[model samples]
Target: MRIAHATAATAAAALLTLLGTAPPATATTRPAGPPATTARPPAPIAWGSCPDSTADTRQQCATLAVPLDHADPTGPQLDLAVSRITAARPDQRRGALLIVPGGPGNPGLNGPTNAVRRLPRSVLDRYDLIGFDPRGVGRSSPVDCGLAHDDLSMTTLLPWPAPDGSVTGNLAAARRIADACTRNGGPVLRSISTRNEARDMDRIRQALGERRISAWGVSYGTYAGAVYATMYPDRTDRIVLDSNDDPDPSRVERGWLAAYATGAEDRFPDFAAWAAAPAAGDQRLADTPQQVRDLFLRLAARLDTAPLPWPGANPARLDGNALRAAMLDTLYDDARFPRLARLMLAADGRAELPPAATPPDAAMQNTVAASAATMCNDVRWPRSADGYARAVAADRTAHPLTAGMPVNVMPCAFWPTDPAEPPTRITPDGPSNILMVQNLRDPATPYAGALRLRAALGDRARLVSVDSGGHDAYAAHGNACGDRLVTRFLVDGRRPAHDTLCPAEH
Candidate 1:
């Protein structure tokens, strides 16, 4: 995710939950619901002195010791970092709202703090906001592959085909990365699947003493939310799935990985316009919008034939695959469009790129890899190199913008451990309190993918499509219509009777 400058953030569990600065709501009340959990802590629990980051200082920070595997709940539990900021408005208070973050890899503890600041005072008045790092991530028993310094580069993680669509190099990287993880990751890594995350969430909910928890999840978290709602239907109150994922249980991450092709095709126009604009200072990608596309493809092809030498950068060469990876990562938002344009401009000038932003500590990387490993390892990818070759070749022809990265192989293809447990299946038989908000042109979690989730959820959920691009529309990108819809459901326990589209401008 780095070279693409697209990874979420590399924050640790403690730092993520340690602080908050959000203002408090007018009135207040401690929310209530399900009975307290009967699950015993593995060891004597210790309460530490901590100050509330927000007005909801009623917020408590603690560690939940869940089993590394629920199948062995009492065998050996792992520590899960948890934080909660209860509602300040008593009369209006309803229940707990869990902030499930994106990323088979993002830490959600930070997300609750982020949401607390942006939450409408009315909404903040009534619910306890809970955020956590899913098991095996951040503060939990972490997992790592002990990858080499070189393997850390995102360009190495994303499998992009050779300029001519050859899968040779990609295959090698896949095998290498997979081996590294299998060798170093140990037992904990095998325990990090989305299904396990769902199990962890249920355990957290049980620990929180809540009958149902409302959720606002982004990116891959959307998948977990859906899985949780499916697995623990009665335990869900009002759920808002933002920047959704494809619910093709058959392919899971495979579908998400493939969606990037169309995702790029759909979102590129937005980046092209940004790069072409005169106001785009320092980013001289192309004067004309069409030229941006042409120039990128041209540069990529040229690099394939003659990669420009650039010191300090991963590989020390400005290659076609590197350029393509950067573009795909930067297209997440219009605000990042210039970053990609500048990278393109530098490639043209035979200059080096700035280092991708990363978490300051090794713990963060290990946590992220743990999260990603779970998702990548839980499911199976085609083992046949021939299948990958054909897929990459087809992707190149079908989506030139991505150059086959979408359908290409990842470490999953070679990941040694299969899921220790079966993947959780999502069904619409859950509560009708679920609300979905999605951007039509999301690059990572595209609208088409959201539809698959929508179709899967059926009557158990309602959809509010935002006429826009980028991820997480509910609060970050959701317009008035979408925002009001979710807010009403959270505050008043109401929902739309049918699927709806929230106009971008509204």
Candidate 2:
């Protein structure tokens, strides 16, 4: 869910803790048992400065220790970084609102700072914003596969097939990366799984002394948040899941990856319309949306055979796969449409190539490793290379814009370890305190997938279908109607009696 954008920011991590309040009453049933976790609550944090000097001065940080394996509470533990920005009005405080981030690898230690800027004061007055980095990411015992810098490229991390749609190279790369991770990734990396992440959230809740927690989870975080809600229904208050991924337990990350094709198709028209507009000026690719699409497809195919020289890029060239990757990244937000249009122009020999957008090598290493670990550790993927070839072939024909990359072989196919536990199946058996806001055309977590998650949560959730494009909905994408509704839910603890829609801004 953390797809790289034209200028995607690198992730960072740190730690923090906060005091908690007993949760308000909810309709959720608390399973009758001596609690699931028997470990005593951790001591309150000695909060201090955040690692990033730029983080809001008020955002305090600290670290929590959680078991490397939740199954063994007394086993070796790892540091979990957390951050918090306390409520402005303590008298109106409700509880801690955990800002769960996306990208099984994305860091959330800075989430409080990020959320504080966009969230309304009404909500801020009622809750302390809390954030944390899941294990194996950033400062929380970060792990790396020590991958060759070349494999760290977005084009490679994603299983983009050979120009001829061959799976031979993709399969080899998958095996190679899988082997490297196994050789270098220690127990910390192996311990990275969604289930463990949910368990860690519970630990954070206990450490804060909160009987319950509210959360705003985005993209991949949506899936993580759902698991936490389902597993600890009684422990959750107001829940907002933005840009959801399908919670198909059987497929899990596999389904998330494959959804890219559908996502690209769903979002491309928005980009085309933006790029082809008369106001686009020099960045415009074509006179009409259809012409823009045709131009991009033609340019990509042309580059598939003859790449344009791009100084300073990983491969030092702009090829079809790289172009495809750029397209996906730009589709995340409409403001990035120009980035893709410029690339298309350059690929077509009408303009000079823009500077390569590369993230730091170390961040890429940690992200790629953690991402693969979570995806593979959550479920077992088919190991057959031939099967991948067939799927890629079919997906390419079905979704040409993505060129079969969505269905291509990934390191998970050759993962060194099997999943430790089965994927969590989200059910309607939780507090009906969940609110979901989704863009109609999110290139990463598509609207169709959000619908699936909405269906899975059943009576427990109400969907705010925003008629817009791009990722993240609430307080993002400029839809006042959608933003007001989500903020109302977080501050007032009120949700629509049924699903609703927020029409696109004209």
Candidate 3:
């Protein structure tokens, strides 16, 4: 039941790692064509030392001006923060390899630096690793809805239902959130859709003076990269989409939300086994995986009626939905398993409650607003309350862990505007230069969804499915086999002749 926005900052593999925008006038379809050209082509980037926080003098930063609304190129423009780590061996340089980070709201300014350290020297020597914050994000022109602190909580933002499964509160919250963005998001917010992001990427390519740019896109970024490949086939060189989403033009983000039910189900076994191990110590939940599952179910059901007082938490209590959301988040990475274990320990009266984790106020407001704008603006949601109620009830019965949140209401249901354009339909007509790497049990972008994207691309793409349990695939949770395959594809322009599956890393 964790919202997509909460998973935004989860892919900093190095840290373990540790760990938007505006509104616009009348919505219009994004323009389709070659990268923009002018009497004088976009000026070449004048790179300089990165911010002090980046602490990597080898990385350089620059800014590019892109139209706020691609459909209205003459309208106001926003500056996109861009960064790059030049190829180590210029003589072997192949081209630029752009890193497209996840979260329609997430920034990619530091991605190149991180990627350079993880990628093989062969690839690093051949490509100038590039990264940029998309419009209305990070160092880009950001937009915030100014939502109240409580409303910024993960539990509230995700639309968790009442104890009795009543969605009355969810409906009201969705409306309130949507109204806030409408009132404060301005024209830039309305411009934040997947199609526009792709267009902005093309603008970046033009500014970088690359006729054909290679890319490495992850999670939500996979979808954006696919759209870019679909819309501008000839302009792309090597393309890698890791942990992909289903490119169902009709459902898009709504489909991603619904997939969490199955995704969580697919991934929980790994956690149950981990939690039940002898090494788990006092944090262990049960003697066996089945027992662990039963324990969690019973605990959640009990909390529905009697939530525990949880000081420092937004709602100041540990309710069933909050527990469910925490479980979802913990399932994303095995490294996060202790978070749920500790929570369960506290709930069972075996330990004290851990301090709740809260993101910075400004960061939360900006990311939530941007996530809502992109999800809602990309496609229309079913506005009928009855329809949602039926879907949620059915989903809750089928997938108890998610507790109907997957099909529940979101701010998109109350969005004020229709999608500005139809989603880009992924097709096999594009160049067969795309390589996809995905984990079998990813909690955010599930393997089943990745299959859909693989199928959508037909022979144009090959998938290297890793038998793993986590969100990210390559160089993160993936086995060496999967990593080797991806490295070969990116570094040497070599790809397997067919879709292949690599055994899980032990």
RMSD for each of the candidates: 8.6, 6.7, 3.6
- TM-score rank, highest first? 2, 3, 1
Please provide, for model 2 over 307-368, each residue's C-alpha lDDT reduced to its tens digit, 9 standing for 90 to 100.
98887777788999989888887778778888888899888778988898667677677777
Query: Per-residue lDDT for 1-506 in model 1, tens only?
Result: 11111343431211111000111222221112122344563443233423345424444667878877565555777788887776878777788888886666655555556677778888899988888877766656766667666655556666677777888987777777777766777767766777778878877777777777888777777888888888778888888888888888778877877888888888888788778888887775778889989998988888889887656656677788877866766676666676677778777874456554433446445644665575565566666779888888888989998888777767776665454445556777866878888888887778898898898888988888888876557766537888898888888878888899877683
How well is each residue in 1-506 modelled by candidate 3, as lDDT tens digits?
A: 11132233432111110001122234555444433544234578888877747546788898888888665576688888999989999999999999987876777898887787678888898999999987877788887787888777667777667767788887877888888888898877877878888888888888889999999998888999999999889999999998898999999888888888899899999999999999888778899999999989888888889889987776788988778878887887888888899998888788888887655667677777777778888887877788888888888889988888878888887787678777778899878999999989988888999999999999989999999998778888648999999999988889999899999668
lDDT for model 2, on a 0 to 1 scale?
Answer: 0.82
User: Which 10-residue span in candidate 1 carries the lowest summed lDDT?
Assistant: 14-23
Report model 3's TM-score to 2 decimal places.
0.93
Q: Which model scores highest in lDDT?
A: 2
Show where candidate 3 strays beyond 4 Å. Answer: 1-40
**Candidate 1 local accuracy as lDDT?**
0.70
Off by over 4 Å in 2: 3-6, 9-37
- By summed lDDT, the worst window of 10 consecutive residues in model 3 runs over 12-21
* Shift of residue 221 alpha carbon in model 2, Å: 0.4
The clash count for each model shown is 10, 6, 14
